[model samples]
Structure formats: structure tokens, C-alpha cells
Target: MRIIFSLFLVLSVSTIFSQEIETVQDSAIVKVDSLYREDQFYLGLTYNTLQQKPQGVSQNKFSVGLSAGFLRDMPINKDRTHAIATGLGFTFNNYVQNLAITGTGEMPFYTVLDDKTVFNKNKFTQLLVDLPIEFRWRTSTYESYKFWRIYGGVKFSYVLYNRSLYTDDQSKVVITNNIDFNKLLYGIYLSAGYNTVNVYAYYGLNPIFKSAEVGGENIKMKAFNVGIIFYVL
Candidate 1:
């Protein structure tokens, strides 16, 4: 009887000891995974509009912009929810407006078409390399995939290729790599939302044209964009 009681007591203590060991291992695993990062890759599509437009200038059709890039997320806090990110990206912007580009050489004449002027297409396109730096804040955890986040940043873009096309029943004018455009573009942008989809906006800090003029007025148009952005692991 005494031997049987001793064996039962030993078994109970062993079971409790094993359970404590397992709990410690599980806690260690969670601690290691808490140092996770987010928003390494992103793709965005935006509706583009012109701000500070010259008199009589108006957009004709849908002006769209597409962007894709990778960002390096660096956490700044112990919880890993506050971070700073910087990355390199590419952007393609198409602006469809009534700004007519005529003549050639070092300078191109700019004219804003009136309602009486009939045209099939009048648009300008830009392909740019983008450098983005952002400050990010989020309510995220290692186990949670859906969380709220807000990211605001400044983006610097360099135009690698540009084109201006105007066509009508009377004539067609095509300009490529014109020096009139500002090659270096900088802007402020903000993105905020939950989970994968975010609302995004960008406002250009400088004019689109360097020193171009339309009817004795400086072409001071800047870019304003609003759209959706997605982030991937």
C-alpha cells in the first residue's frame, strides 16, 4: 500500500513539471516572433489631376498613374509598430488635358485649347524613378494580419522619359523628351487605412513646367493625385 501511494505522487509531480516546461517554450516562441516587419512591397493606382492650372486649361479624359516599389521597414520602438521606411520605385503618369504643344527646338509653344477647337487626343506622359521616405504607425501584431495603419511621406521623382502628343483633323504634333518639363519632381503624400487597402494622395510641391508659358502666363500647373494603394509582405 505504501509503495503504491509513493508511485502515484511521483507521477502527479512529473506531469505538472512537464506542463511548466511546455509553457515556457511557448512563451519563448511568441517573444521571438514579436519582432516582425511590414509593408515590404507596394503597388498603387491613382487618378491624376492638375493643380494651379493656367487659365482655360482643362483635363479632357481620365488621367491615371501607376506605381510599384519595395520599401525597407525599420522599426523605431520596442513594440515594432512605429517605423521609418525608405525605398526605390517606378511611376508612370498620364495626363489628358487641353494643353496644346506646338513648335519645336529648345523651346515649345504652349497653348490652351478652347471649346471651339476640336481634337481627337491631347495628352502628356511621364515615366519616372521614385525615391520615397515615410513615417509609419500601425496597430499590428505578429498574429494579426488585418490592422489599421497610417503612413505619410515625401517622394522625389526624376523623369526618365516624357512625351506630349496632340492630334486633330487639321494636324498632329508629337514631342518627346522636351526640356520644358521639370525633370526633378518632389511631392508630399499620405496613405491611411486598414488591412491591405489604403487611401492614398499626393500633392506636388513644384510646378510641372520649368519656365514654359501659355499666352504670356507662366504654366504653373502642379500634380494632385488620389487613389488606392496595396501593400504585400
Candidate 2:
């Protein structure tokens, strides 16, 4: 009788242990199915348009820009439906406006109001470090990465490198000096969509140049960007 009782006790403990292991596995699966994940890598490209161009300047309204960066999406709610997002990125802005950036390395540079015929490619491209902060809402789950989402926030950028490219039938010239661009830019943006494709819009809160003086008249130029935003990771 002692042997039989000992055997029965051992079986009972083994069964309890097996049951507990199965329970834990089941709970883990449930949590995985309910949890939502965020993609931290972002790639953006947009049609860029220069707004409020200095008077007497004409440009092709259809210019484009590209951006890439990483973002941190922090959950603001227990359910993971709301988040505050921020990231660091870089952007390129190109414009075909008929403004020539001319400056001698030793002197102050200025945007000379001129004709496109004078310079083969009279476009200014902006290379900047972009910082974006947004409030996000989404319907997402671990099992389904596809869902509707809306993100509204502001982005600020600091120009790390800037230059003007002017090409002609004979030669291409790059101007680095005497170009007076606002080193810093701040703007508001919004992104909304489902899955990998999203619509985005940005409006600048600052002028594109520190100062634009043509014919002694002060001019202010701003940026307006519209495009698509993509998440990589």
C-alpha cells in the first residue's frame, strides 16, 4: 500500500506540472494575438512646391523631394491605440524656380532674379536634418499589420549642407558661398491612411531664406510639401 500511494502522488504532481505549462503557452498566444506593433523606420517622398516665391520669380510648380529616417512610437494608452511619435530624419528639397544663387566665396551671396535661359539648371536643393513629432491613432494588431491610421504633428529641420546647382550648355557650377538660406525650418504635417500607403502634407512656419532682397523689396518664400509616407520597420 505504501508503494502504490507514492506512485499515485508522483503521477498527480506530473499531471499538474504539464497542465500549468500548457496554460502558460495558451496565455502567451492570446497576448500575442492581441498586441499591436509599430514600425520604427520611415521613408518619405513628396512633391515639393515653393510657396510665396519672391515676386518676379517664376518656377515649375512640380518639384519633388525625398526623405528617410527613424521614428520612435510610444504608446500613450494602455490599449496601444494612441501614441506620441517622434523621429530623426533627413530631407531633400528641390525647386526649379528662376532664381540664380550667386556669390563670391569672400562676399555675401544673394539670389539674383534671373532667367532660366541664363543658367541651364537654376535649381536650389536643400539638404537638412529633419525632426518630426506627431500624435498617432491606429487600428492595428500583431496578426494584421494592415489598418487605418492618422498622424498629426509638427516637423522641424536644420540644414546641415546646402548648395545651388547651375548648369549650362558648357559647364555646371555649384555655389556654396554667399547662399543665404534659413538654417532652421519648422512646419506642421499630417499623415493618414491604411497599410503601407499614406497621404502627407506639410506647411512651413518659416521663410525659406533668411532674407530675399530683389530691387530693394523684401520678399518672403515658404515651403509647401505634399506626398506619401512609408514605414519600413
Candidate 1 TM-score, C-alpha based = 0.86
Q: Write down the worst ten-residue block by lDDT for model 2.
A: 104-113
Residue 226 local lDDT, model 1: 98
lDDT of 1 by residue, 40-130 (tens): 9999999999999989999968999999999999999998899999999999999999998877736788889899988899999999999
lDDT for predicted candidate 1 compared with the true structure: 0.94
On a 0 to 100 scale, what is the lDDT of residue 81 in model 2?
80
Quickly count the clashes in candidate 1. Answer: 0
Residue 208, candidate 1: Cα error in Å is 0.8
TM-score of each: 0.86, 0.79
Residue-level lDDT tens digits of model 2 in 118-189: 555777788899989988899876667788989899999998877777677787667763346788899999
Give candidate 2's error at residue 119 in angstroms. 3.6
The alpha-carbon deviation from the true structure for residue 184 of candidate 1, after best TM-score superposition, in angstroms, is 0.6
